[model samples]
Target: MAATEATKAADDAYDVIVLGAGPTGENLADRAHAAGLSAVIVESELVGGECSYWACIPSKALLRPVTARSEARRVPGLSDAADVALDSSAVLAHRDAFAAYWKDDGQVRWLDSVGIDLVRGQARLAGPRRVVVDGGRVLSARHAVAVCTGSRAVLPNIPGLAQARPWTSRDATSAKKVPGRLVVVGGGVVGVEMATAWRALGASVTLLVRGDGLLPRMEPFAGHLVAESLAEAGVFLRTGVEVREVRREAPGGPVTVVLDSPPGPGGPGGTPSDEIIADELLIATGRAPRTEDLGLETVGLTPGSWLDVDDSCRVKGVTGGWLYGVGDVNHRALLTHQGKYQARIAGAAIAARARGVPILESDRWGAHTATADTLAVPQVVFSDPEAASVGLTAAAAERTGHRIRVVDQDLAAVAGASLYADGYRGRARMVVDLDREVLLGATFVGPGVGELLHSATVAVAGEVPIERLWHAVPAFPTISEVWLRLLEAYRG
Candidate 1:
């Protein structure tokens, strides 16, 4: 639709006004529509958000081939596959197809089919329930205004860095041709996964981290194992180093990086010189909420900051309780799935409030509250050796003063693991609450472990007793048999 036509259409009032059309906003609108409420989602960018085009979908498409080859190489019968390199062009093409060639027509059609309105422009709060888009279009909400703008990558301030045309997470996942020499900065999921993907595509990838470990958020052993696999896959793994300056003399040429630490054996990045040159540089340091410029000040909230919300995702301290902060903007759980979950709770709560229905805020498992965001958030890092974790780590549980006992299991010892691959290597750790005999947390580090995460998520979220879990028998031979080993280890 043209800008004028869109503005004219949005002039009318809606029951739910969603700012940002990511998965969170989309789900929120869907839920509102299901409750017979009119919804309009305003977006400044593509309708499907970052997960559709960049972070989750495209990154996984690029990574799936790398993992498939790695999985093939581990099987003894596929010796020829072990020597074969990935077809980088085909991999890139697959990523493009998954990302829908960066188009939002399908998403727009879906919204239309569901009777949800989409406004294409920047949206900001005018006051209570009023929103103003970029082209001076005014929109009013009767019940709620949900901010689901999600987040953006943070780039650290370094000399000549911004001018150097560095790649952020978006560029890393969507690059046309892989750079011959790629340097990834940050130890988080983005850094490691992209490092794994580009290196497998034949780039001489160098991963730099100021911290000592690759995955600082996960268990220590998870980092150790992934770092080992990355190094073995020919990624120059450098830890305890910082980039002081970046120099790119000519445009689209090699970029030189100078580290703060003194050069060691073969220099800082395993090169002869103290400086590391790369065709492209990626900064995956962190993410910041997109609420910075959404005109929060008009609604008595600080601009450029996280939106604080309650269990039901309603913005706290807002006078009318018509404001909601869903997804990354609220900083509850930054994962996409978690954000969508918040949207559901917030949507139902908003609808109930609109109907003057009582909200069961105190009930932890009520329909209008998002309790799992606090306790059982699950995460999966799609590296060569995948790492999946739900709930707390042992250290986190201990720090939180939970009476916990840690049970460890070797996944290779499971009969299914041997059948899956030759000499499969993996580990599983479950934090058991001694007082309740329920799982507090679970972490799995190995190949093909992502599939096992939801079971752990359910166990932690439901707080199912260990004895009850034991009754949930496993099939004869599968990686899932590791659950039996973990139980036996805990019992012994």
Candidate 2:
């Protein structure tokens, strides 16, 4: 433990101290500074965080070269000239360029330009409104403290797996060399993407899905289509199988896995197990918040492996009311964009409290405010025949006590979607709140659907009426024209 002049001298001085300079934390600091509050950002890792270094940037970079070449090949006229093969060396180099090789000088310069103090070290809650950096330097806050540390992949309790060692999303995304044979132990978005990416790059890929289908959280039809797409891309999908054991074969040889099918409804549990062999084993199971070693208990807040926050993104327990949690750490919709939205709100609230202004929950330009989260949070999977979703599902809306109406359209039936790809087969589902005639949620699964998510997000977030949405026309001969077909179907 370490003491500072502020600990012995000043009681309260800092307006806001944002922890973890990820997209969310950076947004929080930016909003705090914009609110004219003294703010400092503490980050132990890369300033741009996982999204820049490993998750989004590098993964997307790995896909870009192939995606571009594939599109060119799809067009017969350009197919003759399109011989663009992925140069693994060049792709890795470009990804490194995008992430600045994990350097923070560019981000640091930007933060300094915005008048936000940048501190380097791990940070934890010392008290209600205080942060202890490196377990010593105490920075007392007058207003609020935001935690945006984000989440990491959860390791499963498979026997001998930990000892065997495995690759997570980080390792898979930033992989320098593509394995000759890759076995993915999850059928989630990340797993599917990695499988397809490496498969296209000439790696034999196998996917083991504990669930019955791909993207279990999405529409059942979407799962079917995505699974079909994966199969077409040469991904071997094994469903309803449990990984019994994982063991290293030789010093540098392929890893071997023992898998067993669960007891089915019609059978006794006496089935023999199967074996899978791969050069690399990647675990893309899921993610949990990084709440450990953060002194959550000291703040009177009960964090259950993940920090739980309210709709307004405030930590539950605290005596003097100084604790705030945002982003993946808060465990509310772990998307980076949603986290940033909450961070902006938390930052504004902190600045307002410091200035003696009433902290409002949803304002256009207040410190403590959120619009993009509770209303509509969008997510896009950057895989071939991309998947995108926003807002509440039909079931979720009904659970929330809203009578919902669903409108679904197939890509083959929509004019723009027909031209999107020569043989593009995809689906779009829309959940509407019948009482309000507003969109509860929208999901699109097809080629180039990621870009189409923002329009749905705006409609859901802005609460744009279905009638007004009709006036917002999509361009001709574009995939987005499906929006018109959706609106018409909804009206019908």
Top lDDT hit:
1
CA lDDT of 20 in candidate 1?
A: 93
TM-score for each of the candidates = 0.96, 0.91
Tens-digit lDDT track for model 2 on 1-492?
111112333433568888888899999889888978877777878888878887888788877776676667666678768766577778778877887887877877778777777667788887677788887677777678888888899889998787767889999988778799999988887898888788778789989988788877666776788788788878888788889899985656779988887555311354557777889899999898877877777787654467666556777656666778889987677787778788877776676667787765546433455656655878887777778889887777878899889999886677776665566778899999989899989999887888899999889988899989989988887888888888889888
Would you list the C-alpha lDDT of every candidate in the order shown? 0.91, 0.78
Backbone clash tally for model 1? Answer: 1
**lDDT of prediction 1:** 0.91
Candidate 1: the clashing residue pairs are 292-304
Put down candidate 1 lDDT per residue, 1-492, tens digits, no spaces. Answer: 322135574356989999999999999999998999999999999989999998899999999999888888888879575779899999999999999999988898889888888888999899999998984888999999999999999889999999998999999999999899999999899999999999999999999988889888788889998999999999998887889899999999999988876456435455433678899999999899998888899989999799899999999999989999999999889999999999999999999999999998899979998999978999999998999999989999999999999998888898988988886889999999999999999999889999999999999999999999999898979999899999998999
Please give the RMSD of candidate 1 to the true structure. 2.1
Return the top candidate by TM-score: 1
Worst 10 residues of 1 by lDDT: 1-10
Residue 287 in model 2: lDDT: 92
In terms of lDDT, the poorest run of 10 residues in model 2 is 1-10
